[model samples]
Target: MTKLLLINAGSSSLKWQLVNMPAEHVIAAGQVERLNLPGTIVKVEVGHQKTKEVVETLDEIAAIDRVLKRLITVGGVQTLDEVEAVGHRVVAGGTLFKGPIKLTPSRIDQLRGLSELAPLHNPLEVKCIELLAQRLSGVPQYAVFDSAYFQGLPEKTAIYGIPYDWTKKYQIRRYGEHGISHQYLANRAAEMLKRPLSELNLITMHLGSGASITAVKNGQPFDTSMGLTPVTGVMMGTRSGDVDPTIVPYLMKRLGMETPEVVIQELNASSGLLGVSGVSSDMRDLHDAAKSNQRAKLAMDMFVNQVVKLVGGYYTEIGGADALVFAGGIGEKDPVIRQSIIDGLGVLGIKINQKLNEADHTGFLEAQDSRAKVMLIPTNEELAMARDVQRLMDAEK
Candidate 1:
């Protein structure tokens, strides 16, 4: 079995997993939180034991060095050389990459060019790749793109009602994000139902801080909620999911903002749950405030409504769904959110067992007579990345 290190770097944090491939067993998994800031915390989990430490780091390179040292101290590996290869989760591959590929100097340069498409995610991912390549030396590195899964979206579904010449010139089309998680959910749903993936139709919800819903037809991505960027999906922690296009120019004129970027910054950084409730972006916080705050309650209601609307549309687009699969942070843990969204779909005859829904489990939670199965599958994007890494590595042989 080969050992692979999977790296998923976000704007402010770095999540890594060391795994034994082929067997698909995790050796260790953890994250470095609050990078390049004070109170940087390194958290590691090996089997059932977990450890946390504070390291003084001013950048991702320093943060990565600390992670490698901790791996040895925790006995995750005897030496860094044990890690045969590395795989990175790149948020936006654009049209340049249709699938995962080995990371080379040229490929890295191409990824940097796409940074404009995923300003919040791809730049940091590229930085991590460069750091790992230098630190790990000759070890092979691969990039697993989140957008690659939806690269096959139908033209009608992907294109905006804009000028055709503009789309061809600017590449302005729906390129869904969180595709890694959504793809994993679809594969897992197939396993749970014991159905061939090619025969299944699913609506997979990836509701994290950045949320999105994907319509899977015959085991492939048919349509998704996220547009050209991740900020266009269903309501997220801070992003204003879907707003009128004219709002950008209107906000700029009214606020005396010179650039559209200024208005977009607010939509991306200050909107959504935090903007609506004027409270924390977290769902748990929203739940607590909803007991007494009307705005908080409104935010929660709006979130559920948006999710249900998208799911309903996708359900119809796919003709019907065999299963409504839930994954990601909010999808897997928050039973209340799950119930609220599923309840909104009652018109479609989707129902879940209250007892099973409230329980802490990962499987079918659908009621006996519900028209479609409701699955609660925790996403495993790292494992998915490792599998891709293994595939590409073996291909080179």
Candidate 2:
């Protein structure tokens, strides 16, 4: 049956999808949550059914083993060799990569070095690649990156207004995060709108636990909110996006802090919705508490407000956008937040049909084209990875 498994390795959670290779029908998908911690949970959704199990602490490699074992023993796969290819989500391809790469020893090591740029994501990604290669043996492994598509960004848009020579030495530029989701959303959104990608201008938002906004025009990325790091965009579940460059020196002088790295970690992991709301990072929990909780409401307001502001900025940057699309966990399900962001854009020809926005028919929410088309696309990044894998494998064939 030529099965392919796609892996998305987070800081502590590992998400996986097993699909019929070229056919792209998902056989099963699941998440190993809280890896390397006590009470780790393994949740799997097979054939539209879900089951979850909690186990004792297991290392990341152990978690991967357990998942593969479940797919074979518990999920009724006769042979592991049926898995034709494995795909990993590599977060910081930064200029070094622009698309998926078939894993080789050299390529794997290069990705490891890039981890310095995205400490929270790349190391884990490289580990997934390592673990998969160790366990799956002969299967071809591929890597799809989060910073890849943005590598083609215009030179002017990429180079910050700084000492231009430093850009040459450091190679620091806007290597936008969520490249996979945003890129997939941009293309899928074009398809749903029934327009050729080259003719469309879109503001694609990946509003998940972590979020970023991208400005796609003429089938290419024109600009994006994220910069050299994922921590540069709109406020996220726990990131301090777009802080003043001056804050570093001020904090250092005032508090006698050790280094900028320490403060930056706080910005990366300790801020955002969690910091503002003083609640759990999960949006569902925040939404439930927001009714009477003043701070929670304020946090949600800040999140929606920031997204709207970024959309406005990108709309102006791209001259004018034809449509605005949302994807990711929050973007797909949170209709109230979607409507809130689009409410002020009526004059700009962007208004969400309330019924279309509210109706959550299980998976994806494709809204009506009232003024500017509003679509709530549930991003299938694994499908995108599988498509890339097919393309690469075809070249070999």
Candidate 3:
């Protein structure tokens, strides 16, 4: 049983898990929140026991050091050497990386080159990899890409209606993100239904601060909502998803912005729920404000409407769906959002058991007479990363 450390370094947070492979038993799991900010908190859980600490500093290197030390304190490991390998969840692999690969200096440089493709995620992921490499010394590290799963998207689905020459020269095509979560949901859905993944047609929704929906046809990624980058998917916490392309240029001129990056930054950071409602980016906040604020109510409505529209299109694109799987922060926990989206999808005869939908668990939520199954599957991207690492390790052996 190899011990593997799975790392998912986000823009401002770090989530990690230490697990025994083959058995897949989690030794410990934790995260560092408010990174690089005041009141940085580190939380760790071993079994049912949880611990939290307020640390003074948490730059990348310091964060890595703290996690290792906490692991020993929490009895997750006697020494750092107990960890046989490390796996990182890299957001964008582009077309260059189709699967998990051992991280070498050259490979790290290659990944860094794709930073522009995932500016918010890749650079940070690479930094974490480099930091871990120094701290762990000879321990093997692997990168499991989130975009790898969508590499198989059909050409027609991936290509934009742009000039072929430009598309070819710029690699401007749909390369969906959150693929790690989406792929995990699809596999879990297959296990729950007791069916071969190859035989299932699924629509997986990953709705969180960053949201995306994917269509799985016969076990493969058929299509997805995120395009070229994560910013193009359904409405997210702060991202303005699926806006008119002209809006960028129009905003630049209208707002007297010097560059397109300024407008893009607003789209990625100031729009969505926050932009529409002028409230907090969090869904819970929107729910509260929606009670009295029309803009907040509209924001919530727009989110549900966008999700339903994408699900409907994917359903038709896949001929029909066997199950609509929900996974991610809002998708797995928010019954109200789930019900609203499902209610909007009523035209397709999809219905969920209200009692089951409101339950605090993961499983089938579809009503008995519903045409297709509606499932709530909690995504385990870390486990998926660990599995990929194990697969690569076994292959090397």
Estimate the Cα RMSD of every predicted model relative to the unseen true structure. 2.6, 2.8, 2.5
Name the lDDT of candidate 1: 0.88
Per-candidate clash tally:
0, 0, 0
Each candidate: what lDDT?
0.88, 0.81, 0.89
lDDT, residue 147, candidate 3:
94
Stretches > 4 Å off in candidate 2: 11-13, 32-43, 52-63, 73-76, 361-370
lDDT of 3 by residue, 213-275 (tens): 999999999999989877787888888899899999998999999899888878877888889
Winner on TM-score (1 vs 2)? 1
lDDT by residue for model 2 over 1-397, one digit each (tens)? 4688898776556788998867878998988865665677898888867888999987777888888888886573677878888888888997788888899999989988897678778887788788888888978999988887888899878779889889989998888888888889988888777889999998898887778899988889999888888888788877878889898878888878989988787787778887888985667768998988988988888888898888998888988887787887788778888888888565576766666568854323333545566677788888888888888888887
Q: Write the per-residue lDDT of candidate 1 for residues 146-214, one digit (tens) a residue.
A: 999988899989999999999999989999998898989999999999999999999999987678999
Collision pairs in model 3: none
Model 2 vs. true fold: TM: 0.90
Candidate 2 minimal-lDDT segment of 10 residues: 361-370
